[model samples]
Target: MVFISLLGLFLLSLTQAAAGSQLFDQSEVFALLGDDVTLPCRVPSIRSCSSVNWNMVEEFQSITEVVKAGAVTAPGGKALRLDLLKDCSLAITHLELHDARLYSCDIGTLNSSVSLQILEVTESSNPGVDTIELHCFLNTYRGYAPCNNKGIRIKWRSGDSKPINGDRFKVVNPSECFSKLIITKKLTDHHRKWKCQVTQDDTVKATTSYTTTIKGGIEEVFAAVGESVSLSCWATSSLGGKGGGKWAVGERTLTHDMSPHNGPFHVSEDSSLVISKVSALHAGDYTCSDSTDQQRGVNKVRLHTLDVTSEREPEGDNVTLACVLTCTKECGKDITLTWSGDSRNSWQSRSMKVNNLLTNSLFLPVLSMASDEYTCFVHRDSDVMASKKWHTANPLQTPAWVVLPLVLLICITGFYLYNKRKHPKDAEHEQSSVVMTPLYEVIQDVNNEDLQHQRQHKRGTTTTTDDFYDLLQAVN
Candidate 1:
């Protein structure tokens, strides 16, 4: 009886295990044109007795057994045999655009389905010039739906090398069903074999290539620091594929082998180098090359160094050392004054209005004999382009006593002249009157009066007018 009970218990365990080893949901399907894609199928549980099968359902009432596990009904019936049910996934090789459709997977009594969609991508009809604009479109395919309502990856190649993104090239999405790749700047490298690759779900499925001749050489390149830059390495002729471009620092190579994407350095399509922060270490000679392409071209860029120092002075007895700027245009509007010294110290600034010829002065008041350095920076207001340390002049100190003597003399002279003019009538009156009389005339008149008085006394106190007149005439 114990043996019988143990066998029954083992049978019950097997049944429970079988029930747990079943697939719960459908698998995901992916398809791409001109490329192979995988159809994923996963079983939630694993059981020894469970079986899985993959079949292709096509046409009405027609089911073909493509893969089978656990059981087989007919031999040599074009059915794929699966020795292990765990690896029951389907792989479609070299899938065409028409291969996009629903697929089925069945396990024991459970069944699930998946759908896939394919998109076609073609090469650009016009590969575009470095300076000219280019537009790329999708290619046409048979037995496939319109290449609409799906996102496609667009990439390019120049000659045998891979294409990269830069300021000159951009992708534009005009509508839900279409996108355009535009090349803003044209270069001679754009004339080589150009290709467009379409990718769906990280897999490149189709590619189209075109050949176009590019004109002109590289002119100017502008790039930012710390960002990746790509340089176009194309040629003018079809045989110029071997004659591409390269990047260099002085004589050093900065091509793909020396620096990959996100490597120590990078370049743009117009041969612009992107150095992050652009420190002194990044300062060096940079050159773009196309020796391999046989065109043998090079471009150079120089990195500049910048250093700044600021100072502040007290209001009194402070000397300001300012930088004078020579402006080609109006300096007043383009110039700015700033003081950067003590963190807590505030800066004083004044701006002059711009004119046909700009002249700006940064004024600093110095009350005493304190020497303080001041900096004046001039910049173009429109571009914020500043001049180098063009003018470094010391502030001059002026004393108030220098003008004091002249001011006092002017005040004294003005007061004296004002008083003389206000009393003009009194001056005239003083000039007209004589203060001193002749002494002889005064003595003669006194003597005559005395003699007349004596005579009158002598004549008993009576004197006639003729006697007074005679006395006056005798005195005269």
Candidate 2:
């Protein structure tokens, strides 16, 4: 039993050795026009192989006939030769567009023949630009067969001719069946009919091409001081694709922020910079660009500051103060209008319709009859352009009471002075006359006369008594 087992093991080893000797393995193939391409072929088996040969087979042709043989040519018109003992690989130099074909490595003995596909090779061209160096690339991740090797070669050709000799073009392999082409110092002459070709073992050649052209820069659409202006930039061709654009004043990027603005500053969807009030500060070169893709459409815009004349109603007037915003283009919703000074003092605002270049007015009612300094400020939102303060004349009317008090006091004082100056002597004379006409003997009486009259009357009334009274009176 042991002897039988030993014999069976020996036979199994022999069979494994035979299978290994006839085995072959290879890597993917890639090449450029007028460049050398190596076709990888390896023997992993332990058996001693008799010979190894490489064959080229065109896709459009049959591979049945055998032809010339030499160090440079094989029996079937193959473009490469291989040494069996030392090297089982094939080197094809000066490749061409038509050289894109399948190649196979065949190992043979006196009785057996085994073949392995070595890979196809092809040529490619690089893309060019006028004043820039553009690197051209071709990616081939989606190809037949799983390519474990990721290396390729690149070359450059002009107008269906052989490739030029230089290191201006390079090919690199980043992954299995993936490669890229890089070209240095691309010229305008090299922009025509550039192609990229990809090749791998057991797969067909793939080629892609691109055309080159010049790109343009950005331009200013509209720019004015103290006006709501729209700045626009567009690519020369509509086919250039869509990109993001921005408006800038000096180094600051202008955007739409609806917060309360002391001055005018705002923006719109079309990148219209609406400076609510245009001032000298707003007088700078404004730039607009599509920063996302620098594809030479409207890349940059220049804004020029212009002199804007602003006007408004004078102060203390029951007039409407209008802030006019001027612009070359139609004003959009980006513009904000506001009035400063007295109009703002009242905090009363009116929504003014945006006309071509003019705005509506802020009405001031019951204006005071005094010189009023009114200023109308115009802006987009934050950008103030011009502020105009004007003076209005008002009539002066004096009050009656202001002079009445002084006139009354003057009349009273004048009367008192006249009486003193003219009646002083007369007042003294009246006093003297009153003193002379006064009181001294206006009261003396005639008592004796009255007594004699009474005595006579009594004697007549009665004889005796009267005679007695009479005698007595006579004696007295």
Judged by lDDT, which candidate is best? 1
Report the C-alpha lDDT of model 1 over 1-476, residue by residue, as the tens digit. 11222233344334434756333454334334556566655544435323666554333323445556644332352223222233566666666543454454566655545445454444454455434433443322321234432445555544343554455556665533244556554332333345556565666655656554444343222222333333343322334343344566656676654542234654444444445443223434455555554444444443322223334455444434433332222333323444333312333344344432232333444433123443333332212223323222333333556677778877875764476468643332332232233643564455456656766667853678788788889999
Q: Give the whole-model CA lDDT for all candidates, comma-separated.
A: 0.43, 0.43
What lDDT score goes with residue 2 in model 2? 17
Q: Which residue window of length 10 is worst by lDDT in model 1? A: 1-10
lDDT of 2 by residue, 270-375 (tens): 5445566554344444555555545544444443333323233566335555555554344445445555555455444465554345564655554532335655
Candidate 2 C-alpha error for residue 106, in Å: 1.4
Per-residue lDDT of 112 in model 1: 48
Off by over 4 Å in 2: 1-23, 45-50, 64-72, 75-86, 109-476
lDDT of 2: 0.43
On the 0 to 100 scale, the lDDT of residue 415 in model 2 is: 72
Best by TM-score: 1
Question: Which parts of model 1 have CA positions greater than 4 angstroms off?
Answer: 1-38, 42-50, 55-66, 70-87, 91-101, 108-110, 118-121, 126-476
